[model samples]
Every structure is written in C-alpha cells, then in structure tokens.
Target: MSKTITLLGSTGSIGTQSLDVIRAQGYRVHGLAANSRVEMLAQQVQEFQPDWVAVVDEAAADKMESLLAGMPSPPRLLRGPEGLIELARHPVDAVLNAVVGIAGLGATLAAIESHNDVALANKESLVTGGHLVTEAVRRNGVHLLPVDSEHSAIFQCLQDAHSAKTLTKILLTASGGPFFGMKREQLAGKTRADALKHPNWNMGAKITIDSASLMNKGLELIEAVWLFGLPPEKIQIVVQRQSIIHSMVQFSDNSVLAQLGVPDMRIPIQYALTWPERVPGPAPELDFTTLKQLTFDVADEETFRCLAACKKAIAKGGLAPCAANGANEEAVRLFLEDKIGFLDIGRLVEAVVDSESFGGTYTLPDVYECDRMARSFVLAHI
Candidate 1:
C-alpha cells in the first residue's frame, strides 16, 4: 500500500532529494508547494501528477500555471501562503515540510491541526513556534517526526524505550562547516561562494550560509530542545569533520549509542517518511571497511558567536529564540548579497539577541511580531 504525501518546498535541496525517495517508494503525492522556482515546480508537477500545486509567489504562480497548461489532468493550483496552508491541510498520510526559514511554521501547524503526521525538515518551524506545534501535536494525537540529520540521529537512538528512560545528554554532531578552525579575523572577507562550499553536504544557499556560520547548528540545538524535551545545555555540539556519526545519546550509566551514516539528506528524509518501519530505499548502506578514523573536536562558542547567542536566547525562553533566528536569517541574507561582511553575521545576530529582554509566553502573533522586530533590528543595525 502506497502512502499519500504532501510535500512543501518542492524545489529545494532537501525537497528534490525527498522526491527521489517518494518516487522510489511509489508513494502518491497529493500536493506540492514551492515559494518560487517555477520551472522546477512545473517539472515536479509533470512527473508526480499531484492532486494540487501551490506557488507562494504570485508571478511564479502565473509562470507555473502557464507551464502546466496542457497536462492531461493538471492539478489544481493554489496561490500565496494561504495556498500553502490549504495545500498542507489536504489530509495526506504525511506532510514532509522541507520549506525553509520561519515561513514553514504556519504550514507545519496547519498540517498538525488537520490531524496529519509531519516529517519536519524545517527546523525553523520549531525554532520559531515549538510551543504551539507541540501543543497541536499533543492535542490532535499526531506524530511530529524529525527530519534533520542530527535530530533524526537522536530520534533513532531514543527508539529503545527501556534505555531511552536513562538518556542524559544529546551529543549532537556537526560537520563544522567550511570554516571550521578559522578565527574571526580570517572569516571577515569571505564571499558567498566561500560560505556555500560545505565540506560534506550540498544544500540550498541559505542553509549553506547558515552552515558556514554554525547558525544552522544553533537552530538545530533549539529544535532538539523542543523535539526531545532537553535543555540547550544538555545538547553538546561536537565537530565531527567526517560527517559520519550523525549524533549520539548518553545514558545514566555512562553508556553511549551513536547513529552513523553517510552524508545524505535522503537517508533522514526517507526515515522520516517511513518511520518506526525501516525500508530499503534510495540511500545506500554505509561501508565501514573503507571508512577511516572518525575524529571529534569541541565547538568553540567563543569563536562562533551565533552558537553562543542561541544558548542565551533559548535560556531566556519565549521570543528570544525566535528573535535570534530572525536576526540570523536577515543577516545571512545580507551576507549572501555581499551587503555585509562574513564576521558581521555573528556580530549582528548577537547584538539582536542582547538588544532586549525577550522573555514571555507568546502567541502566533507574538512570534511573527518578534520575527519582524528582529529583522528590522538587523536591517537598522546593518
């Protein structure tokens, strides 16, 4: 029996790889959505023949509509964020949210409210609105599966219900990005191409830049908190250059279990889609025979100010993390466009985190307002 799935961010790095898994498994795609990338979205609609498609950008929606003019039975087209929300509520077997940034938060909540299981690739969804998402999941009795490599590794290790009770800490691993051992001075003049050259993974430009700054890891730390009910301090970031050991968990008796795999997004993506029931699919088995020694190093929060800022934000609770994330997103966007220097990314994010006492119980409106304020702060400061 094939499962019906709705895929958001259908033209991104993770989104494209997710399609590979969906195709291999013969699952039905009920709906597909993307912010732009009209040509790619058109190609996907042609291949998958989905029941509905959404283009968040109206101009791109027109392009998508023009591209799909003569299909045998083209899917219904939905436009803008409401289109994304409506497409997410299609009640599929699973909603794979690969949408990037804070934009994915509403769609994630919509999917859960519609009583659909979510395989979350969008870390910002939890980073910005973890409380609301978890509440919706608990209220509706749905599973909120993690799809990020590090969180997925932690999730896989925690599957043993007996030993899981004794879990003490999450040894979250990091690839250390392209600028691992460099000091702040060395990164001051790096370009977008320099940042996008991830040592182990091929990702979208935004995430590639985030990986360069270690902000991606910072966001993951926050996401891990919401997903595993662990504090930010309980999660330790280890720089594993090989990108092999996805992550590890420690038990009370000083025992540790780690999940190891090749650096492939599809592995975690496929796992999220068919969780609790492992199936042989697109990703290949890791070959340890040719594998070299795995190395580990301590993360320097002093050097990666973004990581340090995230610790403070999550500790203060409430809208702080949302603000931190918003600031980083804007800072990264500016850095990518060469409007700001590389080191300025960290400087801007930390300043925004320190600008206010962002502590309070927040509603959805509060989250968006904090996000807006953070972005404005970054814009004003930069």
Candidate 2:
C-alpha cells in the first residue's frame, strides 16, 4: 500500500529533506505547507505535485498560484492559519509537521483529531501541550512518530521493549550547541552569526539559536517525557559532541541500549514515514570505523540556563513548559532581530516562567493562554 503524506513547512530544512526521503521511497505527497518561502514550495510542487498547499503569507500564496499556472491539475492553495489546519486535517496516511514554533499547535491538533499518524519535528507542539497532544492521540488512536533525531533514537531503541515497566530511564543526548562552555558575560555581545553557527547541524535561524542555548535540548526533554510516558526524573540530558549516538534507553536491569547514526535528519524521516517497516534511503552509512570516539558529559546547567529552566518547568507541571516555550520563542525572535543579547534569552524565559500562574491544567485553552501570557511578559520585560 502506498502511504500518503501531508508535509507542513515544506520549504524548511526538515521539510525539504523529508520530501527527498518521500520521493526516494515512492510515498505519495498529498499536501504541502509552509509559512512563507513560496518560491521553494513552488519548486517542491513542480517536483512532487501534491494535491494541496498552504502558505502562511498571502503574498506568497498568490505567487505560488501564479507559479503553478500551467500544471495539468494544480494544487488547491490555502492561506493563513486556518488553511494550514485544513491542509493538516486532509485525509492522509501521515502528516509530517516540520513547521517551527507555537504556530504548529493548531495543525498538530487537526492532524491528531483527524486520526492521521504524525511525524512530529515541531518541538513546541509537544513542549507546549504534551498532555493535550497525548490525550488527542489516545482519543483518535493516532501514532506519533518522532522525526527529531534524539526522540527518533529513543523510538528505535524501544521497538523490542514494549512495556514501560521495563524501562528505567530515557537518556537524551545533546550536541551541546555552539557555546557549550561560554560564560554569560562572554555571550553578552555575541552576534547572530555566532549563534547561527551550529557545530553539528545546519538548521533555520530560530532553531539554530535554540541549539546554541541548549534550549532545543530543553524542549526535547519535555517532549521525550510526553512521547515515552516517562517521569521527568527518568529523562537525562548528556552532551555528546560527536553527534554519532543520538539517544539511549536504559532498562531496569542495568542495561543500556542506544541508537547511533550520522547526524542526518533523512534517516529519522524515512524511519517515521515507513515506521514498523524500515526502508532503505540515500542517507550516508554510519561508518563506525572512522568514527572512533563518542564522548558523553553532564550538561552544564549553570552556563546554559535554558536546560535548568526546562527542568523547573517540567517539575512545576501544568502550563510551566508552555510558558517556558512561549518565552523562549519570543526571546529567540528578539535575539534574531538584534534586540537582545544571547544571555538575555534565557533570562527572559526564566522571568516569564517565574511570573506565570500555573493553573495545573493542560487543556488547549490553558496552554494557549500561558503561551500568550509568556510572550506578553517577555515583550514587556524587553
């Protein structure tokens, strides 16, 4: 049976690579979505010819329609958040959500409600509304395959181990980002260029900044807990600079199992697309002979305040994670725009999280309110 896929954020790094994997495996690309970047999306449409497309920017949507003027049957174009949700709920085998930030929440909810399996690369979706998402999955019987490398690794490691009772802990690995050891004083005047220079992966500016602060790993920590049904304490973050070993799972019997591969999103993407049935892809083979060393160390929570903030959020429960994620998103935006320094990013998030009221509720509205409150708090602080 040919699997049908609806790809959200079809113009970004993960989206493009996911399409590459889909093309290589002959999966049907039923829908494509992006925030803007319609030119690249148009190129994807020309190659794969999905049935529908959604653009966040109206101008880009118009341009996309114009670019595909001569197709035998051009895709129906959608504009704005409503259109993105509509494309997400379209009857498809899987929705590969690669769209960044909190904007991805609605589409994710739509996919889950429609009973479509999700290939989730959007960390904020899980971070902001982990409980809500898990409930939706249960109500709809939809499987969420993690498209992020670390979570994907944990997913692969748990294939043979079904019982959560047997699991002792989930060990999530981080690349430690660019400024792994820099002090807050040193990062006071860092440029966007410095933060964008990720040591392990090439990604979008927002996510790149998240990586630099270890906030990406922080978000992933909450995400892993929700995905794996593990307690917050059961999840540990270790800095693995080589990026060879993505993540690990430890059993109660003192045995550790890890999934290792070269730092490529395609491997995980292909796995999620063909989940429960692995297929070959064009990703580079992990040559362990040449890859001699894999070093692991405790994350420096003192230096990278985001990780500690995430720990507090998870411990606080309820809407704290949502607040943290929302504040971080605003902080990242500010940093990218040269309105804030690198160290101020975490400071901004911490301040908002510290001030937000935790209702101990995980409903969609509660999460959304927390996000709004956090963003507002951050803006006011700035």
Candidate 3:
C-alpha cells in the first residue's frame, strides 16, 4: 500500500531528498509547501502532482499561481502560514516537516492535532515548543518520528531496548562542522564562506552557519531532551570527525549501541517515512573494506559557548530555549548577511538567553511570544 504524506518545505535539502525517497518507495505526496521557492515548487508539483500546494510568501504564491496557470489540472494553491497549517490538516497518513526554524512549529502542531504522525526535521519545533508538541503527541496518540540523522540513529538504537530506565546516557555525535578544533582567536577572522563549508553534510545556509557555531548541536541537545524524555546531563556530545557513527546510547549495564552509516540524509528521511519496516533506497551502502577510521572526542563547551548557553536554557526550562532559538535564528541571519562576525552569533544568542526570565508553565501563545521577544531583543542589540 502506498502511504500518503504531506511534505512541508518541499524545496529544501531534506525536502528534495525526501522527494527522491518518495519516488523510489512509491509513497504518495498529497500536498507540498515551500517558503518562497516557487520555481522549484512548480517543478515538484509537475512531477509529483500533489492535491494542493502552499507558498508561505504571498508574492511568491502569486508567482506560483502564474507559473501553474498553464496546467490543465492545476492543484489547489494556498498562501502564507495559514496555508501551511491547512495543508497539515489535510487527510494524510503522515506529515514530513522539513521547514527550518520556528516557522515550522505551527504546522507540526497542526499535523499532530489532526491525528497525523509527524516526521520532524525542524529542531526548533522541539527546542522552542517541546512541551506543547510532546503533549500533543501523547494526547493525539501519534508518532513523532525524527528525521535528523543523529536522532534517527538514537531512535533506531532504542528499538526493543531495555526501556528508558535502563538507558543511562546518550552519546550524541557531531561532525564538528567546518570549524572543528579551532580556538576563539582562530575563528574571529572567519568569513561566512569559511563557516558554510560543512565537512560532512550538505545543508542550507542557516543550518550550515548553525553547524559552524555548534548551535545546531546545541539546539539538537535541547531537542533530544524532549524527544527521548532525557535530562541535559544524561546526553553527552562527542566530536566525531569521521561522521560515520551518527550517535550512540549507553545502557545501565554498561552496554553501548551505536548506529553507523555513510553521511547521507536520505537514509534517515527514508527511515522516518517507512519506519519499523526498512526498505532500501538510493543512499549508498557502507563498505567496511574501504572504511579507515572513526574517531571521537569531547566537545569543548568553553570554546563553543552556544552549547553551554543551550544547557543553561534547558536547565532553566520554560521559554529560555525558545529565546535561545529566536536569538540564534536572528544572529545566524545577521551573520549570513555579513552584518555580524562568526563569533558574534554565539555571543548574541547567549545574551538573549541570559536576559530572558525562565521557569514557568507556558502555552503555545507564550512560546510564540518568547520567540518574538527574543528576536526583538537581538534586532535591538544588533
């Protein structure tokens, strides 16, 4: 049976690779959405023939409509964030949210609220609104499958394991980005181009910058807490330069299970879509004969303040994580635009996290408010 899915962020790195998986596995793409990439979205619509499509940028939606006008059987077109939520509510077995940052949070909640399982790639969804998302997952009885490589590896390792009680620690692995092993002085003069060069994975500009600053790993740390119901203390990040060992989990009996594979997003993307029933896709198989070495080291939190800041926010609870995410998002944006230096990203995020008050039970509106407030603070400071 072909599983129907609604894919958000259909033009991104994960989204395009997911389309490749869909084509290979014969999954039905019922709807697709993108931020402002109408050209690519049009190509996707033509190829996949979805029931509906959404463009979050209103002007781009107009352009998309114009581009699709020639099609004899044009699918329904929706505009803006409401369109994304509407697309999420559409009847489907699952919703794959690959949208970057907090913009994807609402669609994630909408999908779960509609009783649809979610394949989550957007870390901010959990980092900023974990309480709400986890509650919805429990209330709606839906699976919130992880699409990120590290989380997917951990998820796979935990299958049929000795339960959460037996799990002692999660060894989260980082590629260390392109700036691994560099000191604060070494990174001060780094350019945006230098930071964008990820040693392992091909990702978007925002994520690449986050990876450079180790903020992506930091955000993932907070995300892991909600996804696995673990405390920040139990999760330890290991700087794995090879990028082969995605992540590992240690049991109370001192047994450690790890997931190893080639650096490929399609592997996890396919896993999240097919789940519990693995099917081979286009990703290359690992050849042990040619493999050389896999190395690991502890991450230096002093050098990368983002990781420390993330720990602080996770410990404080409430809206601190949301504030960190918002500030980081803005900081990354500023860095990408050459408005701020590479080191300034972490400094700005830490400042915002420190300034925000913590410890409170929050609603969905509070989450968004915190996000807005953080961004406002970053903008004012910058």
Candidate numbers, best lDDT first, in rank order: 1, 3, 2
Please write out the lDDT profile of model 1 over residues 1-382, one tens digit for every residue. Answer: 5899999999999999999999999999999999989888888998999999999999888888888887779999999999999999889999999999999999999999999999999999999998999899999999999999999999999999998889999999999999999988888789998999999998999999988889999999999999998788889999999999999999999899999999999999999999888998888789999897999998877888999999888898888999999999999989988899888898989998899998878899999999999999999998
Assess the local accuracy of residue 322 in candidate 2 as a C-alpha lDDT between 0 and 100: 92
lDDT of 3 by residue, 1-382 (tens): 5899999999999999999999999988899999999999999999999999999999999999998898878899999999999999887988999999999999999999999999999989999999999999999999999999999999999987555568889999999999889899999999999998998899999999988889999999999999998899999999999899999999988899999999999999999999889987999999999898888888887888888889999999999999999999988888889998888888888998888577888998998899889989988987
The better-scoring model by TM-score among 2 and 3 is 3
**What is the per-residue lDDT of model 2 for residues 17-124, given as tens digits with 9 covering 90 to 100?**
998898898888999999889878888888998899899888877787787786777899889889999999998999999999989988999999999999999988
TM-score of model 3 (CA atoms): 0.99
lDDT of 3: 0.92
lDDT of all predictions: 0.93, 0.89, 0.92
TM-score for each of the candidates: 0.99, 0.97, 0.99
Candidate 3 Cα deviation (angstroms), residue 206: 0.6
Model 1 reaches what TM-score against the true structure?
0.99
